[model samples]
Target: MRLLIADDHALILDMLQNFLEQEKDMEIVAANDMQDAISAVSAQPGFDLALLDYDMPGMDKLDGLRRFMENNSAPPVVILSGHAARDVAQRAVSMGARGFLPKSMPAQSLLHAIRFMALGEKYVPVDFLFSSDQADASPAPDGPSATALTARELDVLKALCDGKTNKEIARDLGLREPTIKLHVKTLYRRLGASNRTQAVMIARSWGIY
Candidate 1:
């Protein structure tokens, strides 16, 4: 995959470029800011994916995103930020972004999200899509707040809601089947459930589904 990574922070740029290029099929072109990213696209014009720092210089929030997406030659884009609120992520998708991702996401998840969104599938963070109701995992007085779940656990729970098998979820999230089993176990413990059906039931009752 050819990637264009744009961030004002040189450290972030280096970090992403170094990590992504470790994949033999991946190549990266780094840019410091929005304008630089636009210029890079003009020069190469064929990046398989572009991950843009949502608050980087010249982004002007979503305006820069709008401009970038309007470009006919632009590759698929996903917004990455230290603080992307639910509304903003929703709005970015409404404005044609493939997804909104958090910078703090585990590197492996980010890689999976990068590939998932690049394939023209939307990859919004599960929490972002449900935060209005579960920001604190707020639920009935007797139940665990879905908020008690980690983002990755929420991801696993959501996959369960979709009725996907452990292997399928593992493949979707770029994790091993054993790691997925571990996540399922963690989800069961966190949600106080013993099986996938009960887990999904509890999650849905809490508005996590």
Candidate 2:
């Protein structure tokens, strides 16, 4: 996969480049700021995905993300930030970001989220999506039910709420990774969710733990 990564921090850029390069099929294109990112996109089109730092230069707030999307609408763009604020993530999603990834995420999870976004899926950290503030403010729907989900599916949903990945869930439940994926697909269909983040929100609204 061809990726365009824009971050002002040289150290971060180096770290990401080194780690992502370990993926045999991945190619890393680095940019120092939003302007650099735009120029890179122009010079090298057809990037599979773009990971933009939330606070990069020339991008006050989400302007960089907007500009990048306007320039290259084909590749999925993701916002990467150290801030874990729910509003920031929500805003990025609203501004057409395919994913919002916290800088604090584990390397494996970050890689997984990237791959997930490449598959035309939206991604947000499960904990960030269901933060304590949102949970407290969210009103429970009357007569809500989780009847749409089977027993195993409910178990998977709970694991998701706890921020477990497919591999981890498979290990914990003594099931194969493919089986867990099938359960996740079923959960998405039953909950009418487009991605894992949306499914978690729907599950929360229904008072499903």
Candidate 3:
């Protein structure tokens, strides 16, 4: 398979390239940023897959993911990020990403995810989903204000505090992206806050983490 991998970090880019080189059947093309990734994909239309860094130059967060989806004919463009928040992975999948791989993933698991995505299957870390579920099942801490938010909303809020995008929160909670947006809206209204930062700050003040 011919893969196009883009990341601003040279060490990561080099490490991934060297690791994938062990696969005799895989041909790797490298890029430093989203712009270079787009140009590389444009130049090599036959690329089987593209792995993009979540926070790379020329695009922010999922913007690069959207740009690649719109510009490339390639199937299964995967996202690689240092922050592998469950919601982020889900959001990427919702936005036409084929997979989400954490930078901290074990090499064997990373290879497995890549190969799985190459075969047109979505790959999200099982541990992420499991942890999300566990969090949901855990008891809420004592706080009268906490009662205003549902368990799921609290999940969303915690993700927001972690700087997760809406799609990521939805993915973490196994809800639709639109549903996550609605939750955020309701959360803001309930908290009497204007935005994510305000909501997080208010929640923190209320002893709700």
TM-scores for candidates 1 onward, in order = 0.67, 0.67, 0.62
What tens-digit string does per-residue lDDT give for candidate 2 at 1-209?
A: 99999999999999999999999989999999999988888988889999999888887888767777888433788989886477778888988889899898889878877876776667776555554555332433333248534477789999998889999999998877866886687577557688989888887887766
lDDT of 3 at 76: 67
User: lDDT of each structure?
Assistant: 0.80, 0.80, 0.78
lDDT at position 120, candidate 2: 62
RMSD to native for every prediction? Answer: 6.6, 9.1, 13.9
Ranking by lDDT: 1, 2, 3
TM-score of 3: 0.62
lDDT: worst 10-residue window of model 1: 134-143
Residues 1-209, candidate 3: write the lDDT tens digits.
99999999999999999999999999999999989998887777888889999888975888777877888465568989886567777789898888888888899868866875675556665454445344332343343366646576788889998899987876777767766766676577567789999998987887767
Q: Which ten residues in a row have the lowest lDDT in candidate 2?
A: 135-144
Between the candidate structures 2 and 3, which one is better when assessed by TM-score? 2
Summarize candidate 1's per-residue lDDT along 1-209 as a digit string, tens digits: 89889999889889988999899989999999999988888888898878889989989999999888877779988888887667778788888888888888889878777776665566675544554553443333344667556577789899999999999998999987767776786577557799999998998887757
As for candidate 2, its clashing pairs are none
Best by lDDT: 1
